[model samples]
Target: MTRRCGFAAVIGAPNAGKSTLTNRLVGAKVSIVTQKVQTTRFPVRGVALADEAQIVLVDTPGIFQPRRRLDRAMVRSAWGGAEDADAVVHLVDAPAQLGDSPADRRAQADVETIIAGLKASGKAAILALNKVDAVKREALLGVSAALYETGAYDEAFMISASTGSGVDDLKAKLAERMPEGEWLYPEDQTADLPARLLAAEITREKLYLRVHEELPYSAAVETTAFQERKDGGVRIEQTIYVERESQRPIILGKGGQTLKWIGQKSREDLSVILDRPVHLFLHVTVDERWADKRAFYGDLGLDYDA
Candidate 1:
């Protein structure tokens, strides 16, 4: 049998469940999931094998109105992911788009912006209405009809990424669209993210889960060292950079309890994913200008000037 391989860019607004869907398709956690918006800062490529086809899923950061340099860079990366893809899936929060809340309105607006961009690019995407379990069937049909009428999408799929509903069907569709070619990655490889970068992302996820509301948007995690020991375990050192001196104590907590908790949680997750014991150390630092540094953006594969 001949092999097929191609790229598929998953683009959507903040909190639209793109990462969740990508993980589902790849059958592994390639991107981190959290309750906060804009959690993903770079494009994560997850490899999924469907029979003879290899689908490279590009999970891009949430597209939103940019106010900061980092925000602009993330949005730019999102579009760049789409420009080079053989297929594009624009995931939307269906329930939110059908609701009247202020947050829902903002989500609907973002979806419209993506639709406009699709039209301008002369690309017909496959619209995937996510969170279908939360919305009524009629409401979903209405939303799907409205979006399809825009002539920007070639097909529509109502799926719940969290529950695995309608995912296999979507995967089959994506596989059918893949062009015939040689496999881009090994069959056993689930993701293309490097170990050091994945470690940093895992710690960063813990940080946001612990101090999301208390900490500002300037927090970043860098893995300074990752070493394999003779005992077949990994030793990792990471630094969590915050924008203010006052934020350090908050992350450290009383008697260093908070930082300890974060480190413990991160280590546990890493051990399970890596299938080995992990010794993780976390330090909180004050770097008010970390977001402005070019190297910081380069590390994450984002263009700093964007």
Candidate 2:
């Protein structure tokens, strides 16, 4: 039998459900997801099989206006993921793109930025208007027409990544684009991320979900150690780094309840993902320059100087 395998880069603005769609396409939780925007900081490769085709999906970071080094790096990575891919899917939050609220306007602006970038690169992408369940069909059609007129997208699809609606069609479309080759990964493999990195990301997602507004963006998680026990479990140690000393208490909370909750929730997820008993230890540290550190960016597959 002939085999096919290729990369498909999923690019979009923050909170456009790129991670959600990627997880759905891969039939596994390869990338972390939360309510926060720009939660994804790097490209995560999730392997999916559609018929005889193996589609390697690159879940890239949200493309947005870059003000900081980290933001620039993330935007660069998003585009870089598309550069070498066999197919590109530009996901957009439909309701937000068609709304008038200030936050919605900002989301639309990010989409516009991506569209312009696509035009400048002279690349065509499959536009996926996400969150169709939350928007009216008439309004979605209008938005789709306007974006399609930009001539940056080869086709458009309306989907609700949260509900798995229209996702299989998109997966099939991506599968059809795969080049003829040997499968890049084993049939059972779902993600390409290292165990240590995946553990850190899980802890980071928990931290982001627990913290109040804006605090999550200022926090970062690093897996300091991942050790396999003799019996058959794993012990993971991670450090949660915040920008200022004042932020430490915010994460720790009164009586360390907040940190405790974060650890417990993260451990639960790690256990399920690793399919083994996971002992997770978390520590909070104040590092004002954590975002500027080259080592931190390198660990997460980001360009520090971008």
* Candidate achieving the largest TM-score: 2
RMSD to true structure for each model, in Å? 1.1, 1.0
Query: Clashing residue pairs, candidate 1?
Result: none
Task: After the best TM-score superposition of candidate 2, give how far the Cα of residue 141 lies from its true spot, in angstroms.
Answer: 0.7
Error of 2 at 280 (Å): 0.7
Q: Model 1: runs farther than 4 Å from truth?
A: none
Tens digits of lDDT, candidate 2, 50-69: 99999999999999889899
Residue range 1-306, candidate 1, lDDT tens digits:
889999999999999999999999999989998777889999999999999999999999998888999999999999999999999999999988888998998898899889999999998999999999998889889989999999999988989999999999999999989999999898999999899999999888888888888876778999999999999999999999999999999899899998998899889989988899999988888889999999999999999989
Candidate 1, RMSD to the unseen true structure = 1.1
lDDT at residue 56 of model 2 (Cα atoms)? 94
